[model samples]
Target: MAATRQALDWPYPPFEIPAELYAAWDARAHGAAAEAAWQRRFDAYAAAHPALAAAFERRMRGELQPALAAQLPALLDAAAARTDAVATRKASQLALDALAPLVPELFGGSADLTGSNLTNFKGCVIAGRDRWGNHLSYGVREFGMAAIMNGIALHGGYIPYGGTFLTFSDYSRNAIRMAALMKQRVIHVFTHDSIGLGEDGPTHQSVEHVPSLRLIPHLDVWRPADALETLVAWAAALQRRDGPSALCLSRQNLPVVTQRAHADGAARGGYVLRDMAGARAVILATGSEVSIALQAQALLADAGVPTRVVSMPSTTVFDRQDAAYQDAVLPPDMPAVAVEAAHPDFWRKYVGRRGRVVGIDRFGESAPAPALYAHFGLTAAHVADAVRAVLGTGAECAA
Candidate 1:
């Protein structure tokens, strides 16, 4: 519907602005520049889409609700505990079970890893054959999965989703970019999101994928911290009507954070958890890294260094908050550390140049995920040490 609303929809002028001339050309774009001229037409094109206008009509009358309006976050924490047991497999079955009635437009599939991706929707009135059921079984074709999802979204009757290993998103990168360019409402569920993929090796572990996905303009990126966080991420994807979103989750069973998930905590991106009475450093993390940061917070407290752990599930949502909100949550002044299994780029903007980040700038290894994590210094102790370095508190955080 928003095929014309995104920046990628801008028409290419007859005279191309060479990519190499970005610096000089950007400087030249004052007011009457070609880019500005192009924007007017793009804006006009956005207004021209008939279905888009209809969607806006709902929003104007308050018919639309924020995607993260309720319970999914808590669902994630609950799921985290279940993942290590037989429950991970069953919860997805339960997801299909719950959606059997209400989410007629809902669709999903696996990238040849049905047993692992855990996204299978059974019982459909329309598809007739269980073979072509509402949910598509995309086999190992990541590109086909994304492109097909784009088509499903463009058709206006469905919210298509698919799953694959986190590292494999690269195979579908072009299709995903097109979805962002088209502003399609598709979801990509990536499992085994880290070195925790274990013996699968560097090619399988998703080290640089987080920032790579974040770099896309219209995509919302999520790395859920627990089972409940996973639910929030899923609900957020369903609620976000304008564009695409991805949920990155662990292959290993990470300990659940709270007794249960809190929906509000999952949607707003970064939320403070386990704060010290007086915090000297703020440790921010997403996905499994949040668990590490939480442990680091406790260890730092025991050593007399007060630290606050921040769980950041979605960067795009957090960026939506006002400056005051961002300041309140991130507080540029606090000594900070950003931790994740992925590359460091995504955290820099949040933590600031002076703040430290415990992340991988390199590829993962073929060894067991736990061994690789310790080998690369990605532990609670490592995150705490980063905080200690920032605080200059003289307390050793290393094990």
Candidate 2:
């Protein structure tokens, strides 16, 4: 091979040369020259792009920033003022609309589901064949989009993100795993998170995706409840530098059940959203089901069964919290019940032996979201009933 390479002039490494000579040549000449040239180019680029250079510097310094985090309260306040329910995906878009302009290092795109994913916002420019742009138009290719975002994150100088339906995350599974394994800061926007994405049927429903993604070590899976939680999820994804984040958003509109005061606790991954005197049980929920849990809380109150509601958006993050905080939020002695529009098995660990999970363990049908929720027993009354069952009280207990 060496002789053939020499003859063909393929520029193979010079094994015939003395080891000392090659080492000395590269250390004093080739390597030094390359380092100097690269340094000069880097300095030029930094001078040309001050904002981007600063963003990279902040990232390298591990500055989990609060400046951007401080702005979240105002956004939450704005969301609370709105009377209508908002889809978490659309809420995420509103968040991006406010924060994207401030983050020059943020580069995002959608896998040909731009309208549905709401990843692209106003003032966004698509990367063309010739010149570079902030966003990509990854057409109908979930795996390709995820892999390319991984490549971009590996290359540095930009925070890469991509969007697709929650069910389609299966296609990007390997790439998403690689991101978690490498501890890369890549964000995945997975909308249509549950049977709430009605009419799409079982093929498009994401019954197991959120829990499956949570099983990935080092990856943060956030199923935010409302606009405020959605913004917090986005901010958390941006601040995290050691691992990837998956934002499992909702298709159906979620009532603004959260308040501005919950912002700090929300960032903790889980917090008690509603506390009641003489509470006999705790109801844990995420995403669209959070509102349902709140409604269940009301029903339980009316039924003379006091219960507290805990909005647990990110179980991975919650698990990382201090034992004191975890215990404070979820006491071991308390009977707990979890409600979500996904697989039931994932909640079993949290709910304990005495508790139960109100979730869909079967395939969804094509129908309106409300009808699906009703058929699947994902309603507030069902959750209230679950709490009653866990507490050993039946319908007769409701006054």
Candidate 3:
């Protein structure tokens, strides 16, 4: 080939370079010049349209919409006052319905699970070609929906979120990682967060999704216990401009356990829900498990164990709190038992060496929610046993 090229005098002093090749070589410069020219035009337009330009700039900075900010306090108050039992997902729907109208930049939809995810709100027009809309129908594309949310966030002027089953977070894991790496404020609504999703089988249940999502740096994972906590989580996710957030919601109804006075404490990620006088041990739990922990506290109190229940909705946020707050919530001197219907490994850090964890390290089985709880030993009885074990009052339970 070399001899043939020499014979043809290819690209040497005897041959000229192709015009197309030269044009191709110059394309980068041309593109740069074009971009500079477009920027200059944009600058001139911005100068002429100062107010619009300022709004655009502010949106890119991820500033909360002024109107939305004004309405947040009252909306949160209303959400906190809700005393009826409701699933966290439904509570999220109510929150979105109330806030979406005020925050025009809040745009989101589910991955073809709108009915189950409860992500769509009233007045959210479907996005279509040649017309802008607030909500997008992501259509059963979990990974695609997450990637697209990242794009929307990176493009600016909108906060984007998407929903899917917590078990399917595996399919969107890489995209979630990218969102975290980019520090985009993309919200992921993961419903049916645990085996409590019931009768869906182990295939549909999320045994480790909560801890898995929590492992990702810069990604805030929240498993709210009740309607008020869910509202606070949603608010925190929207207000978080520097990172992504995962809201782990339950399918079963959760009663409003945290009183209105302490409801806002959800923003702190972990807070004392029920404190008992002369408490020697603390029960830490999240999501549906928080209610179980509360029940366990009552059981322990009846047994003269004197236990406290700490609702830890978001470990990521709690870790960011001051040492004093952390110590106050999970005291060093007091024994603690962490409870969740997922992996136990992550809880070992909060619960000291002597402390026990009430969780299912193995896959779940097909059964009713109550049966699953009994089989998996996730009931208040089990949590109370674990608390007693941690306090050296009883033998260690088989959790």
Candidate 4:
């Protein structure tokens, strides 16, 4: 094996020339050798899977972008051009298709956790959920998982996404934060959100994770309320072309919600999920937490609070909303509180000093989610208490 010095034009140190790997010398070399090596690999792949090979070639040259986007041509071809909501739901499919060709480094696998995380990408790999057969698997080692994700993103062209229990996100917090700082497009599929995680116990519940992740600046955290939103969220994260994104999903199957108007859900970030009356207070929530907020709205209504619930999947998007829109969603007359199983840190801006927020703001126990909710104050009663506190009907509780 022959090795050359690092390329002056390139950013990092030189790569090692493996003694036995073919084209190891040119992996870092300039010109024809690199292109030729790619061709050889492509031809071999094409011979084996012609469909994938053709798609891969189109991707290499950048002809597959618009088709991957949920806009005109491809949408028309699919005969779903008029169905914006359905198109939005298909964003994840488009993402996988668009990404399948460009970054071979974009690898994913679940920890016996694919169904929950939505971490499996088609035309990719087949493996036991516990195994790393799909290029890389972090297993249940969430810390290492996040660290490896950071490495892949920092190295470039590799958008690494992985699956994990939402509660386990705490273990990988630092690495996740670093990915945010570096602004890499690493995907994190966090499942089993909230007490909805059921008998899994407080140990598996992710009450604090909601606000903790929202605190990261460059990290676009999206807790999609349903399957379509999940697809859209993944697509939006990929199109970010920069920054890291975390998708918080649920263990429980959420009802599918779609509208023919919001086909570009992924790119747009956030839109009115179901806006009725822009009432006095806006109930902001995400993930499994959103359901709580919706129920609270009805409870508040019978009590005469007259509230509006906003499914704010992306805080980053809500923050970017114009001042008028923000004020409209969250009127000054009606003080609001953010309800989620997580901490309250992420709600300060929206709920404000005058408002209230219902969140975990604490650690977890080894017990189950029901008991944990009792301990952490995440029940419907707790949510109502938060609303009353924010509305000045009750005193503020100590953090």
Task: Give each model's whole-structure lDDT.
Answer: 0.75, 0.89, 0.88, 0.64
Error (Å) of candidate 3 at residue 49 is 7.4
For candidate 4, the 10 contiguous residues with the lowest summed lDDT are 80-89
Model 3 spans > 4 angstroms off: 1-54, 395-399
The Cα RMSD of model 2 versus the native structure comes to: 4.2
Instruction: Give one digit per residue, the lDDT tens place, for model 3 in 1-399.
Output: 789887986755446767786787877888999999998987998999988888777888879778777877787788878889999999889888887877668888888898998888988888878888888888878999999999999999999988999999999999999999999999999998888889999999898888889999999999998888888898899999899999999998988888776665779999999998999999999999988898888887777778888999999999999999999888999899999999999998999788999999999888899899999999888988888776677653333
What's the TM for model 3?
Answer: 0.89
Q: How many residue pairs in model 2 have overlapping backbones? A: 0
Which regions of candidate 2 deviate over 4 angstroms? 1-31, 44-70, 396-399
lDDT of 1 by residue, 37-96 (tens): 777875786678856755544533323333423433434444545634322233344545
Estimated TM-score per prediction?
0.77, 0.89, 0.89, 0.68
Candidate 3: residue 312 Cα off by (Å): 0.7
Write one digit per residue (lDDT tens) for candidate 4, span 1-399: 123333433333448445564565545456778898888987998899998777666544423355346453343233323233322223443445545554454578555566556565666765455764444555678888888878866765455787787778888888888888877777887777676667766668776776778888888888776544555576667667558888777666544443445445333555544444545566776655666666666666656555666667778766766877766556667667777777777778777887777777665566555566577665555665567666655542232
Write down the TM-score for model 2.
0.89
**Model 3 deviation from native, Cα RMSD in Å:** 4.0
Distance from true location, Cα of 144 in model 4, Å: 3.8
Q: Model 4: what TM-score?
A: 0.68
